[model samples]
Target chain A: MKNRLRVLRAEREWSQQDLADRLGVSRQSVNAIETGKYDPSLPLAFKFADVFEMPIEEIFLRD
Target chain B: MTTGHAKRRYHLRMAVAMAIYIASLFVADWLIEDRGVTGIAAVMLASVPGLCVAAIFWILARLVIEESDEFLRLLYIRQIIIATGIALTGASVWGFLELYMLVPHIDAYWWPVIWCLGTGVGGIYNKLTMGTSGNCT
Candidate 1:
């Protein structure tokens, strides 16, 4: 999956650690998801949507 | 609990298990070799270290279950798979060599040690390839 996580985080002036904290995940998980090394599960994707205050489609896209 | 807390507990449990394992080895050897313990009593004595080793692995298993981060959990499962592969392959190859009388016989207990060392190798691999050791630290 491709995601606008970096852009969104940048726009919000949030570091990866900040996003990770919001998502209750490790910073490494945020990095892996941002770098496209990993895809988030459905529940975690929902968490991302909740954290980003945007729809999952807005944050993540089909590759 | 948090992964950090879980890891701390894991370390503590592992330390206790290792101490017991070492002490059991010494006590078992003393009873069997010096005190001439035999039969069921000696067998029971020798099983203590193995049980401790099993408990150590059980603690690791609990860590995996306790880890909340999906990525970290995935990494841990991958590491375990890699470690299991290495340990089993090493043992199988060594078994063949022993069958052919090309290598000295080794105690069966060494396989768990190999598995433990393989986890270290897996950690190194995870660090190199995934940018994190996946150790939950």
Candidate 2:
């Protein structure tokens, strides 16, 4: 999966740790998701989308 | 979840557990060496509850990591299984050698065997029953 988390966070001037804190996950996990090292589960992706106030499809798309 | 927080808590518990184990070992040694203690008295006076503390450390470490993720747990399981296989094989070989070739030496070998089994075997038991991968941390 490809996600715009980095872009979204960048736009908001938030660090990975900031997003991780909000999402209740490790910074490494956020890094993994951003770098495509790991894929987030659907529920977690939804949480991310909800946190960003964007549609899930807008934030994540298939590579 | 805070990995840092969880890691700190787990490590603290582990350190304390190790301290208790070491203290028990020291006390056992003191009793055996300085006071010439042996046999069932030594077992009752020291070894039994040392075994129990070691057992409790394994149990409590699991509780400390109860909120950890799947990847970490999987890593721990693999480490433990490998360690146990090594320890058990070593113990069996040593036991066989003593039973066939030596006298009284096998009795002396008990602590090494127990220590290996307690550390690896206990961790294995802890990681297996805890199902560590499904939690929030």
Candidate 1 yields a Cα-based lDDT of 0.90
lDDT of 1 by residue, A1-63 (tens): 999999999999999999999999989999999988889999999999999898999999999
lDDT of 2 by residue, B21-135 (tens): 7777778778988999988988776765456455644754574466344334444545455555666776777778778886346554355446545445545554454432222
- What's the count of clashing pairs in each model shown? 0, 2
Interface RMSD values for all candidates: 1.0, 7.7
- What stretches of model 1 exceed 4 Å from their correct place? none
Alpha-carbon TM-score of each model against the true structure: 0.94, 0.60
DockQ of 2: 0.20
| Number of the predicted model whose DockQ against the real structure is largest | 1
Candidate 2, B22: how far from true, in Å?
Answer: 1.6
Q: What is candidate 1's CA lDDT for residue B53?
A: 85
**Residue B129 lDDT, candidate 2, scale 0-100:** 49
**Position B54, candidate 1: lDDT:** 87
lDDT of each: 0.90, 0.64
